[model samples]
Each structure stands twice: as C-alpha cells, then as structure tokens.
Target: MKSFYIKIKSFFHSIEDNIAFYPALLSFLGFNFAMLMLYLEDKGISAFVIEHAPPLVINNADTAKTLLSFLTGGIISIMVFSFSMVMVLLNQASSNFSPRVLPGLISKRNHQYVLGMYLATILYNTFTLVGINPKETDKYQLPGFSVLIGIALTVLCFFSFLYFIHSISKSIQVNSILEGIYSKAKTRMIRLIEKEKKESPSFPDTSDWKEYGSKETGYLQTFAAANLINICKENDLQLKIIPIPGAFVLKEIPIIKASKAIDKELVEEILSNFNFAQGEIVDDNYALAFKQITEIGIKAMSPGINDPGTAINTIDYLTELFAIRLQKNDDTIITNEDKSLIYINTINFSELMYQVMVSYRTYCKHDMTCVQKLFIMIKYLLLQQTNNDHYHNSLISEAKYLYDDATANVENEEDKRRIEQLYKSLPNKRE
Candidate 1:
C-alpha cells in the first residue's frame, strides 16, 4: 500500500513537472468559466447586468459578434506566432547551448502562464461569439457582459504577449541561463542542508546484503526515500540503493542491496517506488545542474562554437556551485522519525569534482584562456577549504591535468609560459 501511494505521488509529480500541465489546467478552468457565463446569460443574468451596470457600446449582438470575431482571429494569429517564437528559441538554445538546458527553458512558469492566458482568451471569445443571438426577439441570449469580459481578457492577453516577448528574450541570454542554474542548485543545496540538520536515525550496516536488480533500463530520475524508509522500518530491513538519482541502470542490474533476503513479491513492491525516465531533470537531481553547466561550457569551447568567453563564464558559475556544494553534506541516507532504514550511495566530493572539471579540462585544454580560467577556479576552490585534504588533492589533480594539456597542446611559448605561471601560483603545485 505504501509503494502504491508512492507510485501515485510519483505519477502526479511527473505530471506537475511537465511544461504543459499548468497551462492545460488553466485552459480547462477558463473553458468552464466561459460555459458558466453563457449559462448565466441564458438565465437573463446579462439583462440585469446591462440594466444596472455601466452601458457598453458593444451591448448589441451584431457588435459583440464583430468584436469577438476580430478577437478570435487576432488571438489565433498571436498564439501561432508565439508558439513559433518559442520553437525558434528552443531550437537555438539546443543548438547553441547544451541540450540538457532545454528542460529548464521549457519549464518556465511565465511562458506557461502566457500560453495558458492565450488559450483561455481564445476559448472565452469563441464561447462568447457562439452565445450571441442575432435574432430580433432573442435579446436575453446576447451576452453583452460576457463580450465585455472577453474584450478585457483580450487586452490582458495582448499585454501578456508583450511580457512574454521580453521574458523570453531575457531568458535566452547565456548569463541568465547560467545564473538561473546556479541559483536553483544553490537553493537545492540549502534545502538539503536544512533537512540534514533535522534529527535523523543512525545509519545501518549493510555489509552482508542480498543484491536486488532492476527490471527495466533507464535513467533513475527519482525514488521515494521516505516511503522506502517506512517500508524498511516495517519489515525490519536495511536497504542500500546502489545508484544515485541520475544514474542509468539496466535490466537485471543490482540497483539495491538488502540486509536480509526478501521474497520476490516484496522486492517487486519495493522497486515500484523508483521512477525511471529517458532524460535528466535538474529539479529532482541537483547534480544534473553541474552536469548541465559543464556541458554548456564544453559546448561553448568546441571548435565549431569557439567561444572561450562563454566557457570562462560557465566556469565562474560552476565554481560558485561547487563551493556551495562543498559546504553541505552529500545526500546519501534516509530514515524514519526514529531509525535509519535506507542508505543511498552517492558520488563523493572527489568523484563529483572530477566529473565536473575533467570535461572542461578535456574539451577546453587547447584554449589557453579557458585553461587559465580553470586554474583560477581550482585555486579559488582550494582557498575556500580548511582541512579537507582529499578535496584539495582533487583540485590539485585537476590543475595537474590542465598543466599537462597546456604543455602538450599550446605551441606558443608565451601562452605556455602564461599557463605555467597560473599553475605555479596554485598552492599545492607538484614538483
């Protein structure tokens, strides 16, 4: 039953994460509102409104029809144009930036709200047009108030369209994208820290455990840790999940290991709480932010793009993110109110640093400026540390790799000398 509830929750979470979910919901509400207005018109509600409310020039059916018709046509054109612009933005972002960033761009709430407003306005105007009765005696059927409402909504949509344009234009800027990712990742890290401060159960020993494999193959997007903890507490078991949230697990591969051998039915039930999907979602997994930013930097440094400035900027944001992450404990355990039940194996600091920095070093090695920026990044990170020798070693290792790449690839003596100067400036340069 717990697993079933988790599945349901995961289902809704997936839906909520979708870009169109809120817009579709708003459109549905708008459609219902249009219907209610028409129903009120049928009951002579508009007549009372017309008599008591201020007079509208478009009170007549013919005028209402003309206005609604024009609005419908204009809104349709605006919607088409808006959608086309969105597609163009997505295409450009995917081509110019990393494809991983497409999810963040697609999930912008402002864009969704604008598109939903357009949909609502279109539905409201279409319904209002149909509600108008042109016959001489059908005075009560002409929804004057509804038509006025439609006009007001159309104006709001126009303004929203303008805002959408400004918002999208600003959003596409590379600096904005990098800052947005950094901000989100920082926020997630803070939340993790707060959660860790809360009283947690002791970590359980899982030395002697039976491995449980997955049934399907895909990127493990998320899992219900709390639910799994509850299940473990109830069954008196300790389960250690093998892969982190963003790992790709194949069928029959061990994804979890249990302290005691469990029945196949119970194992299947436990596995149901995990969600596997095709793409990485940064919202669910903060590590993906590092990956996404790294990809953007790599893409910027590619021969085709040849934009080392963007790569350097990406390094700046990455350095900030890494500094923030270093302050927080890695997410690797979960427990109930009283006892630890689930232990997740997460990427360690050294491995995560390598994963993030190695790509930049590999791709941007030939560019002296990028290499120098990387050295500065490592130097900054090393300064932020106090006694974490392992992390310092990792940073120094990265610097060494950068040094090796520069000496091998940079032909100009002056460029190589500059790189060597930066490398020597690092606190722990190898002899």
Candidate 2:
C-alpha cells in the first residue's frame, strides 16, 4: 500500500506541469457548480432574484440563449489564442535562453489558473445554456439566475485573458527566467541547510551488503525518503541508495544496497519508491539549477550568440546561489528518531565547484567581461561567512584556475592586469 502511494505521488509530481492539469481540474469543478446552479434554479432562485433585483435576472429565453452562445464562442477563441501565445513564448524562450527553463515556465501556477478559468467558464456556460428548455418556460422558469452567473463568469474570463497577456509579456525576458531558476534553487539549498543533521550518519560497511539493480532506465529524478525510512524500520534493515536525485540510472545498474540479502520481491518494492523520469527540477535537486545556469552562461558566450552581458548576469546569479549552497552540508543521511535508516550519496562542495567552474573556464575564458566576472564570482564566494574552511579552499582552487586560464589565453594586458589584481586580492592564498 505504501509503495503504491509513492508511485501515485511521483506520477502526479511528474505531470503537474501538463498543460491540461489545472484546466481539467477546474472543468470538473465547473460541472459540479453547474449542477449546484441547477439545484438553486429548482429552488426558485430566479423568482427570488426577480422579486428583489428584477434588473439582474435574465427573463427572456432568446436573450439568455444568444448571450450564452456568443460567450461560448468568444471564450473558445480566447482560450485558443492564449494557448498559442504560450507556445510562441515557450519557443522563443527555448531559442533565446535555455530549453531547461521551459518546465519552470510551463509550471507557473498563475498561468495555469487563468487557463483553468477559461476552461471552467466555457463548461459552465455550456451547461447553463443546455438547461434553457422551452417546456419549462411557463412556471418560475427560464433558469434566469443561471444565465446571469454565466455572464458573470464570461466577464471574469475576459479580465483573466488581459492578465495572461500582461504576464506572458514579462515572463519571456531573460532576467525573469534567471530569477525563476535562482529563486527555486536557492530555496532548495536553504532546505538542506535548515534540515536537522548535526551528527554525520555512519552507515554499516556495505562491502557485504547485497546490491540491487534498477529494473528500468531513466533519470532518477526524486525519491521517497520517508517511505524508504519506513520500509527499513519495518524490515529491520539498513539501506543505502547509491545515486542522488538527478542521476541517470540504467537497467541492471546497482542503485541500492541492503544490510542483508533481501529477496528480489522486497528489492522491487523498495525500488518502486524512486521516481525515474526526464527533466531536472530545481525543487527536487538544487544541483541541476547550478548546471542550468552555467549552461545558459556558456551558451551566451558562444561565438554565434556573443552576448557577454547575459553570461555576466548568469555568473552573478550563480555567485549568489553558490553562497547559499556553501552553508548546506554534503550529508545525505535520512534518520528516523535517533536511528539512521538510509544513506543517500550527495556531491560534495569541492566537486560541485569544479563542475561549474570548468564549464565557465572552457566557454567564457576568452571574453574579458566573463573572465573578470567569473574571477569576482569566486572571490565573492570566498568572502561569505561559513564555518567550513573546506568550502573556502575549494573556492580558492577555482579562483586560481580562473586566473591561470586568463593569464594564458586573455591577450589584452589591461584585462590580464585586472584579473591578476583580483587574483592577488584573494582572502586566502593557495600554497
């Protein structure tokens, strides 16, 4: 039962970004609302409206039918146009910025709510229009109040369409995309820092533990840590998840190990809790955010694009994100009460810095603006307060590597002088 819940949660998380998710949800709500209006109509809501506020009710069947028909057509047009605009912006963003950003953009809840509003309004009006029957027109009939609500919903959708127009305009800009990535990644890093893991969890020697292989292939995007802990405690076992989130898992690859040789059935049950899918979300894995930002900067520095301003901006964002990351421990221990139940591997700070810096050194090394910015980025990380000298040492190493790369490739003397000066101003010297 727990394993099934894990798969269900992961499936929803994977599809939250689907274009139809919110729209489909709101459409169902709209259907229920229509039924509610039908009940109110049966309860003489239209007659009550006619008694208190005659002007607000729609008495004429022809007028109500015409208005509902017109609204349904108008809303369908608006929905189609709004979706097309989204596709165009998505395409433009993919081309200009990074394709990695589309998931973030697609998952914007505000936009989805607006789309859902459009869908809901359409469904509501359609249903209300269907109830305007000829045979029931003699008594307290006409579904007058329902027609009024439909009109109200149509007007609201128009306003929502206007908001969508204003929003999509600003969303396609480069700074918005960078900030979106930076914000989520920073939040993720803060979670790691805030998570309680004072004592490093010591895992039992896994040399004798039985290794379990993945049954399928995909990127291991997320895992159910709580479920893994529960399963371990219930079975009286200590387990080690071999790969971190965002790792590409292959079929038959050793993805986990158990303290004792567990049967293949239990192994499959445990593996079911891991979510393997495409796309990297910063919320699930903060490291992917760093990689995405670096890729954008590198792409900006490409000879064809040649936008050093964007490269420099991306570098500045990375610098701030790295500062947040500095406070996070590399420990990936999941504990239950005082007992440690699972060990998940995580990339250490030194290795993370090298991975980010190597790409900048390779792509942006030739450009003076990028070279100086990369140097300052490293220097800035050096000055941030942290208890870990190891993180500082990694910064120092990356800083020197950047300096050497500039010294060898940066031909301009003035640029070289500035880098050398920044290099000399390092908070800690590399011996």
The prediction achieving the highest TM-score against the true structure is: 2
> Which parts of model 1 are misplaced by more than 4 Å?
1-7, 136-138, 199-207, 429-431
RMSD of each: 2.3, 1.9
Q: Which stretches of candidate 2 lie over 4 Å from their true place?
A: 1-11, 134-136, 197-199
Q: 33, model 1: CA deviation in Å? A: 0.8
Ten residues in sequence with the least summed lDDT for candidate 1: 50-59
lDDT of 1 at 89: 92
Per-residue CA lDDT of model 2 for 1-431, tens digit only, reads: 76668778887987787768988899999989998999889898999999899999888888889999999899999999999999999998888778988888988989999999998988899889888985565536989999989999999999999999999998888898899999988887877777744555566677878889999798887877777878898899998888877889899999998988888788987988888877767778899888888888888887778899999999999999899888877767777776888887788899999999999998877888888788788878888988678999888988888888878997889888988898998887775
**Please, what is the whole-model Cα lDDT of each candidate in the order they appear?**
0.83, 0.86
**How do all models score by TM-score?**
0.92, 0.94
Q: What is the lDDT of residue 86 in candidate 1?
A: 91
lDDT of 1: 0.83
